[model samples]
Target: MDNRDAVSAFLRSRRERITPEQAGLPVYGQRRVPGLRRGEVAALAGVSVEYYTRLERGNLKGVSDSVLDALAQALRLDDTERMYLYDLARAAGPAPRARARQREVRPAVRPSVARIVEGMPELPAFVMNNRLDTLAANSLGRSLYSQMYADSTCGANVARFAFLEPAARRFYADWERMARFAVGALRIEAGKNPYDRELSNLIGELSTRSDDFRVMWGSHDVHVFRESTKRLNHPLVGVLELDQETLSLPDETGLSVVVYSAPPGTAAEDSLKLLASWSATTGQDQHTESASEPSDRHL
Candidate 1:
């Protein structure tokens, strides 16, 4: 998708969410649209209606930071939305020379990184790149997301599992909300890395295959990942209310570690322990099977 269209759609979506009353504007006549009129937005931003109209029509190139800030204030955008606006603006600018390097998908994970995930035995932790590809995960992490790993065709893609796999509907308690959040996170990543071919392809595939994904993607929402509570209906351990913490790996750009945990003495914590036990048993069985296999040299 073109950056200009993204910019226009994002701004329009933000504008359409705020009513005149919410914007502290006096309601006058019958409103034709749901939110504040273009003129009202321009007035609130202290800009000309024509200029704001141009901006809303996908012309954000060369726009000053001050004007953007004013527009953001008028729209009452939060920090995440404001950052997304900046990302879209940067994307609309001249293409960078290093974009080709940035577009490379599936960067190799360092052994140390994998070890770090493995070290966190109690918590279900996994490392994923910006494209939401699961590069490395602990045993419990793998167990927690067993459904995603069940189908090799999907690989370790959280987005594909969420939208394409039927198990996702059963795994995530709030399936629709999780789906929207996943798409929004992907949208944010797309704005930051427009040249990412893999991300583009994934978006295309999801849009083509899932009608719900297509509709949510069309909304142009953006989300910044942070700590959140998730309710998972695990097939083995039943329900679990886990808290998620997403930590960025500074050395590895575009990669982050997501760890899931529950409070002490909670039923969720007991469920997590049960899950860990199951994972341990499963791992031992797999290890034994691999060890029992006859070596080619012996044969």
Candidate 2:
């Protein structure tokens, strides 16, 4: 999982997606490729062809911020894509600095964070890492994603569940759209943390196990999860159209708290109330079952 390969693929993908006309460049006769040629992009960015060629070859080392900005402008990169490009360049810096940037991302949730999630009894809230692992979840959050939790194969990873679980298709109303967003988000994380072994393994596993993931991963799209509406078909509570908000922790832990809520006076709101009640009842039953288990001495 060399970062060079990622850099090369991302640049080429972005380049090949744009046409000369899109970039307001005059097209020459019989263009071999659909996108603006390297020279055209270089000219647009006010860089020499050789320099842009060197960048496209994945050697972003010692790249300047102004040049990166110029490239981003020439490529028409959106905010998220621009951030990803900057991250890739930073990762391409000196070995010691890059290593310093690669800090160990702890998967454990802080007690205060867990308490905050638990305190939000009305909303389904969970804490997740950059890898899309649901590290901690409130009772309602767990209930909301019961299908994902039931399938132990993904180990509570959202990306894995979306790609690897068959039930996911039925669980999400807009399966294809959600899957693409998930893929895009994962791609962004990969760009930020290229040295993470767990993330690499997760991407490799998804690529190997799911054809849809493999195809979507090839697009080189990027996304940052902020706020979105998710239409979910829960087995227990039926349809739930919830608005999800992702808030990043202030620290460099790469952890975020995702909270889902429904608008008042909507059917989704009614469903959430019912789901909360059901979650409470089920949780009590599980607690009772644990308490009633026979002791080792008795056995």
Candidate 3:
């Protein structure tokens, strides 16, 4: 992906989303385009129209922090959006420096992290990378997301399961909202790590396969994961309203542990208990079947 195109699209998208009145600027008779005009944004940001146009054209290279801040304020960007703009600017530095940044090593799930996931027997917990690939999961986590695992085509990727698998539409009660959040989060990652080949490939796959993904991705929205409630329709346990928490690893490995839990004394909590029992039973059955199977020697 071209950094310039991304930078240009992001800035233009943000600018076009805001109206002149919203920016506290006086509106003239009839507007030729949506949102505030380039001159209006330039005036608001305390920059000349020509300079603002240059920046908007995707030449964020050598842009100062203060100028970025001014543009952020003029565009009424949220915290996440402002950070994205800064990331884009940082990426637009000297070619050699940007190339150095491009060579990233994929992080592995450390033994301690695996242990932490396994330690949570009662809760559904898993570790995922920036691309939402399920690196590891506890027994209950695997059971909770069995449908995603069943579809090998998804490659244990959350976004792929959501966009490519039809079952995901039913599994996630609020599919549209969840899908948008996923797209937005991926957009933020792209801005920060523009040259991530795996991430770019995943985005390309989703865009090609899912029309819904295309619309959401085109929105250029950004999101940072936080504690939220997710309603999942588990095939085994039925509907479960679980609280989701995402904890990022301190080592900056781009890996996050996601845990799901339900409040005590609620139906959702009861369902979780039933789901755990089912997982255990399923494991036992698989073990027994495997043990009883005839060996190749016998054949």
Highest lDDT among the candidates is held by which one?
A: 3
Question: Model 1 compared with the native: what TM-score?
Answer: 0.89
Candidate scoring better on lDDT of 1 and 2: 1
lDDT of 1 by residue, 164-228 (tens): 88889999999988888889899988888777777788899889989999999998887765638
Ten contiguous residues minimizing lDDT sum, candidate 1: 290-299
Residue-level lDDT for 213 in candidate 2: 93
- Superposed Cα deviation of residue 49, candidate 3 (Å): 1.0
TM-score of each: 0.89, 0.90, 0.91
Q: For residues 54-166, write the lDDT of model 2, one tens digit per residue.
A: 99999899999999999999999999999999999987876744553454435456677878888887798878777777767777887888777764422278787788888
Model 3 lDDT, full chain set? 0.81
Q: How many backbone collisions does model 2 have?
A: 0
**C-alpha positional error of residue 68 in candidate 3 after TM-score superposition, expressed in Å:** 0.6
In candidate 1, which residue pairs clash? none
Clashes of each: 0, 0, 0
Q: Clash pairs of candidate 3?
A: none
Model 1 per-residue lDDT at 32: 84
| Per-model CA lDDT versus the true structure | 0.80, 0.80, 0.81
Worst 10 residues of 2 by lDDT: 290-299
